[model samples]
Target: MAKTWFITGASKGFGREWAEAALERGDSVVGTARNPDDVQALVDQYPDTFLAIRLDVTDRAADVAAVQQAAEHFGRLDVVVNNAGFGHFGMVEELTEDEVRAQLETNFFGALWVTQAALPIMREQGSGHVVQVSSIGGISAFPTVGAYHASKWALEGLSQSLSQEVAGFGIHVTLVEPGGFSTDWSGPSSKHSEELDAYADVREAASKRPSASDPGKPEATRSAILKVVDAEQPPLRVFFGKAPLGIAERDYESRLATWREWQPVAEEAHGA
Candidate 1:
């Protein structure tokens, strides 16, 4: 059966790839981008199968309205992809409060609001999938992207809890943690703080990291996502890319070691 998908940030990158894949498979897509013109090409191509809408994910009201609009247009929404977010690069001290807030607004709260809006519709229909596009940084922090990591970490926690909360209603939640993908996430879509000489080493290391033109392929991501959407029961958390899986394993191992090393201290805190 063909599904109806509502995808945010569908103008480019993984979001665009997902939208294209759905349309090619005979599914209809309600694709949203901040600049409608960015997705005009898709509208021209998919015509009857695609509806391009202008949206700023940070606006809760607008997000809710967009969700409703999409559902009404397609008569149903089978999947919702919260893929509208940008990367913020800078040392913790270098980022302004406003910068951090802006990142959280779009990456964390934006998804939260969209989920909130979509849940009711899904609940009424008794089925739907919500895909949250996080990053490997959500599970492990790196130098220079503290704000971005914080936002994704919050999103991970939110999505995990949401998956449990909505299971009774037949709504599934998926958290996608992608590593070095060939997306504009690290290029035109990314934001950077003012350079500080004190953080030269951090900046230098970050500079060597891969960019949007790197080895990762968006098509692979799209295919993986489609598989997840088609599955009878999708995973709670899915990691993409070789680097992300390796990093996640190392992070969990380090966390286990730290927990064991601090077990005595943790036990003592019980006041036995």
Candidate 2:
């Protein structure tokens, strides 16, 4: 069956890769980007199967309208990929209030609004998939990217709850926790705050850590996503890279250990 996919931020990075893969598989796609022109090449290539639309996911009303329009145009939507977001790099103290708010608005609230719009359509049809693009930072924190981590963590929580609520309606939700890829996420797509000397040591240590930009490949991510889309029973949450997979495993283990270590203290608070 050829599914109709509605993907946000489809002009570049993982979003673009997903769109291309779908079209190659003879699926119909409604690709949304802030600048429609950015995705024109795809429209040109897959003239009958692809529709490029201009959209800013932050605008709730506009996003709803676009989703509705895409569904109407395709006659039905089988998948909704909320892949529209950017990375914000800076220590929490260094980032301004507006910067933090902007990060949350696009990364967390943007996905929320898109999900709200897509749910009714999916519920009516009784079948659809919603893919939320999060990051390893959603589960584990790192220096210099605190704001980005916070936004992804919020997204992770929202997608987890959404999966439970929509399962009865035959609507599936997948939270993709990708570590790093050879994309513009850390380069042209990311926003950086003014550096402060007070955090020099921490920043230096962070810089010494392995770079996310050169490790993962976008083609591999595209293939993994396609598999998830085609699965009869996809996982609620999946890690996309070796780094993310290992990080998540270690993080949960550490969390469990800490909880057990303090279990007595926690139980004593109840006065039992």
Candidate 3:
């Protein structure tokens, strides 16, 4: 079957790659960006199968309208990819209130609104997939990008609950957690906080971290995404690169050890 995809941030990076992959494989896509002109090339390339439109995902009403337009145009929406997000570089203390809110507005609330918009349609049709483009940062903490991590972590939690809630409606939700990808995420699309002299050492050490090396190719993930959306039972969470599993394993191991160590304390708190 030729599935229909509604992808946010389809102008560049993973969203563009995924949109092209689906269109190449004979699927239809309504690709949205803040500037529809940015994705005009894709529309020109796949004239029949691609529709490029303007959408700033942070606007809840705009999210609803875009999803409705997509469903109406294609007659169905089989996949909704919330891939429109950017990295915000700031220490926890260094982050501004407005910065945090803006980050959540796009990375967290944007996906929330889009998912809310699509759920009704998917439930009525009894089939759909919602792919959240989270990062390995969602699972682990880093020095300079705390806000980005918080956004992804919140997204992870939301999608986890959403997966269970929508399963009965034949909707599959997948969190695509990628490692460092060779994309504009940390480049043109990224925002940085005002550098503080006190955090210079922390910033320096973070920049030298081993995990920052060997960025995955953005185009390489196209096939993986294709298989995921095409699956009979897609995973609730999946990693797009090798780094995430090791990161998760280490993070979980440390978390489990700490939880077990505090088990007695936790139990004592329940005294009747």
Candidate 4:
């Protein structure tokens, strides 16, 4: 059976690639972007199978409306991809309150609203997939991108809980964490905080990281996404690029070591 997909940020990057992949494979897709014009080409290319919706994911009401409209148009939504978020580059101390709020509103709350909107429908249908576009930053912290990391980390925790909650309802939740995709996420689509002269050295070090210099091609992830959505038992978390696995391994090892080293201290807190 052909699946129906509602993908946010369908105008570019992984969203665009995944949407076109599904459409090309005879699936139905409702693609949303802030500007409908950005995705109009897809609508034109696949008139019957593609829908372009104007959506600002941060708008809670509009997100609900878009999800509802997708279900109505397609008769059912088989997949919901919350891929509409941008990277915020700022040192923790350099970030302003508004910048932080804007980062959280779009990257964290945006996905939350869409997931909430899609759940009832998926629950009623007894089957669906919700794919959250998280990042490698979700699990690890780095300089100059603290706000982005915070947003993704929040999403990571939320999706983890959501997966366990929704499993019995036959709704699958997956967090797609990519390691530096060759998208505008760190380029044109990225937001930056006002720089502090004190952090110049930190900024330089951050800019020279592997993620800044090398990024996987965005189009290469289409097939992987298709496989994930089509799987009978999809993973709760999946990494889209080569870098994430190594990063995860190193991070987890360090974390385990630290935790183990502090096990006595942690146990002492029980006052036993």
Candidate 5:
């Protein structure tokens, strides 16, 4: 029962790892990166199971073409992993219009565009799994990463609604909420806006705060994601990292408490 997968951002991080896992499971993958050559090394490792492709998920026209190419090459695509994303760290007030646009373009609208193109094929086949490599940033707020959080938050909402909309078509959508890992994320992929440097004193302190980059923390992310990829029926949300697990839980608890106390008000809003 081998399956075919189309995964974005396969050059590194969770994308590369997930591509490995999928191949290990005997699945064929069309692993995509901005520079398809970036994945040549991976392609060399698993020649038969992987196809490297260049993809900029933000380009709607090109994205549709990529999906069509995958479906044609693989004959059918069973899984779509939207893992291409980046972070923009800066206070909302400190960010520029261009920086905000770039943040949302890659993290939010890119996923949306890819999903829109992939849905037609999935609907035709009546089966597919769409995995979004999101972050805990989408679920909670933090200093300096407000712009990043906004993009992820938008993704969370879009993916959740997509899950409900595509359920009847046998398409499963899962959101992988990862905190951090031992990757080059802090490099260009996670950049700070220059305009925000005026608040450097405050932002510097925030940056020094504990993150998944701490020793031994990234391993937890690796293990958690592999677990999700192996699940027979993955949940709508798969939280990665020890810190994210706790953060997600607390967020859920507070949301539940609010719902409980305000059920009457909530119910009235919808006439429940």
Candidate 6:
């Protein structure tokens, strides 16, 4: 069956590649980006199958409208991918309050709004998939990318709660944690929070070429999605790349050990 797909940040990166992959598989796509013109060319190529929407996920109303438009355009939406996000790099003290919110708005709250809007349509239809384009940072943290990591970690927590909340209702939520890709994540698609003078040295260090934190291959990422989409049951989290695999593995081991070390204290608190 040709499923209908709603994807944000479709102008570039995984969003664009995923939309293209879905369309190539005969599905319908409503693609959105902050700059809608990057998608104009795609819409022209796949007139009957594509609808390009202009949206900035930080804008609540605009986010809701984009999701609603996708549902309405396709008569029913089968999948909604919240892929709009920004990377704000710098020491925490260097970022302004607005810059921090802007990062969370597009990365965390943006996905929240999209999922909320899509839920009604999916619930009405009785089945649907909600995919969040989170990052490997969702599972771990690094120095310069603290802002980006915080947003992704919050998303991970949200996904944990949402997975259980929506399970019995027939809706599924999946989070993609990519290591790094050839996407513009290292280039224009990414953003950096400015220095507050106190962290001038930190900002300068982060601006260096080797300071980029993204690590997923675009083609491999697209392929991973296709591979898992049709599986009998997809996992709540999919971590892409050798780097993430290693990091996630080590993180799990360390956390598990810590938890066991404190098991008696935890049990006492729970009266177990």
Which tens-of-lDDT digit does each residue in 1-272 have in candidate 3?
A: 99999999999999999999999989999999999889998888889899988999999999999999999998999999999999999888889999999999999999999999999999999999999999888888889999999999999999999999999999999999999888999898999998889999999999997767888989999999999999999998899887889988999999999999999999999895
How does residue 114 of candidate 3 score in lDDT? 98
**Would you list the C-alpha lDDT of every candidate in the order shown?**
0.92, 0.92, 0.94, 0.94, 0.82, 0.84
lDDT, residue 262, candidate 2: 99
Per-residue lDDT for 107 in model 6?
A: 92
- How far is each candidate from the true structure, as Cα RMSD in Å? 1.5, 1.1, 0.8, 0.7, 3.1, 2.8
In candidate 5, the residue pairs with backbone N, CA or C atoms under 3 Å apart (3 or more residues apart, or in different chains) clash, namely none
Worst 10 residues of 3 by lDDT: 209-218
Q: Can you list the residue pairs that collide in candidate 2?
A: none
Give a tens-digit lDDT track for model 2, residues 71-105. Answer: 99999999999999999999888999999999999
Candidate 6 local lDDT, 1-272, one digit each (tens): 77899998999888989999998888899999878899998889899999998898878898888888888888998888988887877787677788788889889999998888888888888888889988888998766788899899999999889989888878888988887677777578677776577776766765663314654568767778876566557889987676778888889999999999999999899973
| Model 2, residue 223: C-alpha shift (Å) | 1.7
For residue 120, give model 1's deviation from the true position in Å. Answer: 0.3
**Candidate 4: misplaced stretches above 4 Å?**
none
Model 4 clash tally, residue pairs: 0
Which residue window of length 10 is worst by lDDT in model 2?
207-216
lDDT tens readout by residue for model 4, 1-272: 99999999999999999999999999999999999999889998999999999999999999999999999998998999999999888899989999999999999999999999999999999999999999888998888888999999999999999999999999999999899877999889999998999999989888799865678998999899999999999999999898999999999999999999999999999797
Better of 2 and 5 by lDDT: 2
lDDT of 1 by residue, 110-173 (tens): 9999999999999999999999999899999888899999999999998999999999999999
Error of 6 at 129 (Å): 0.3
